[model samples]
Target: MFADGLFILFTVFAVVGAAGLVLFKHPMNGAMSFVVTLIALAGLYALLNAKLIFAIQLIVYAGAIMSLIIFIIMFLNIQEEDLPAEEGRFKYLIGGVIVVAPVGMLLTKAVNSLPGSEATIAGAGFGGVKEVGVKLFTEWLLPFEIVSILLLVSLVGAVVLAGKRGTNK
Candidate 1:
């Protein structure tokens, strides 16, 4: 019962945060709202007993990614005057909802139709950091390394572009 309540609370928070992210006019405000969503998702992962995922959600997404987003936003130094008037934004939002509502309903129905399974206790070391580390290093090493390299390349490219922009100013 406690877990269920917490789940509901987290779900509500996540939804509210997502809505705030979408509805906020300023990029910084939206980014802050996104942080709330990410943190709520981490709480949900904790409720699911996914400790590593919870930590990653907080650390990688809420911490690192959000900081990077905020940094970029700050670097851009956006002002209210710089923002373009968003005419017909509400119309676009309504149109988007109209297009997406059926897909949402279909997905909900599909999930509800799935077979229910008995709750089973996980084995020892299941979802533990060490076990996940071993699997990630052994089974998923190549893909992981490729992703790391890709991130490094992107980081370097961003730095180069930023440097070029600075020099141009």
Candidate 2:
């Protein structure tokens, strides 16, 4: 019962954070909201007994990634005048909701169709760092390496673009 209550609380936090992320006009506010969502997701991972994922979520996403995002936002120093007028934003939001409503209903139906069972604790060593590391290094090595390379390339590209912008100024 306690776990279920915590889950509900975390879920609500995540949803509210996500909404704030989308609804907030300022980039800094949106980024802060995303951090809240990330932390809530980490809590959900903890509830699921995914210790490795939970730690990674907090350390990598909520900590490192959010810091980087906030730093970039600060570096950009966006002003109100820099923002584009959003006269049609409400129309876009309503259209987006209309498009997504059917997909949300489908997801709800699919989840309801699943067989209900009592929650079971995972066996010992489940979600352990060693276990995950072994699997990630062995079975998922290629994809992992590919992702690392992609991230590196993107980082380099961002640096180059930022340098260009600085030079132009």
Candidate 3:
């Protein structure tokens, strides 16, 4: 019962946070909402007994990633005039809903059509840090390295762009 309640609560938090992330006008507010969502996801991971995932979700996503985003926002010192004015926002939103609704329905239908069964208990070492580390370093090694390099390149690009903008101004 407690687990079920926690699941419901965290799921609500995640959904509401995601909505806030999308709907908030200010970038800071959106980033905060994303942090909330990430934290809720960590809670869900904890509930599922994925302790390593829970820790990673909190530390890597909510802590490191959010800090980076907030740092960038603060460094940029964005003002109201910096944002582009949106015209026909309501019309665009309605059009987006029209486009997304059918896709959402189809995905829902596909999920519902899947064979439903009770989840079996995970064996020893499942979701453990050691197993995860081994898999990440072995099977997923190339993709993992590629992702790290991409992140590094993106970070450098962002710094260069910010520097250019500062110099231009």
lDDT against the true structure, per candidate, is 0.90, 0.93, 0.89
TM-score of each: 0.92, 0.90, 0.83
Q: What's the C-alpha lDDT at position 18 in model 2?
A: 96
Q: Give per-residue CA lDDT, model 1, range 1-169, as digits (tens).
A: 8988999999999999999998888989999998999999999998877889999999999999899899989999999988777888788888988999999999999999999966677777777799889999999999999999999999999889777865746
In model 2, what lDDT does residue 58 have? 99
Q: Tell me model 3's lDDT, rounded to 2 decimals.
A: 0.89
TM-score, cand. 3: 0.83
Model 2, 145: alpha-carbon shift in Å? 2.5
- Superposition TM-score, candidate 1 onto the true structure: 0.92
- Give the RMSD in angstroms, all C-alphas superposed, for model 2: 2.1
Name the top lDDT candidate: 2
Question: Model 3 shows how many backbone clashes?
Answer: 0
The residue-by-residue lDDT of candidate 2 on 1-169, one tens digit each, is 8999999999999999999998888889999999999999999999888999999999999999899999988999999888778878888998999999999999999999999977876889999899999999999999999999999999999889777865746
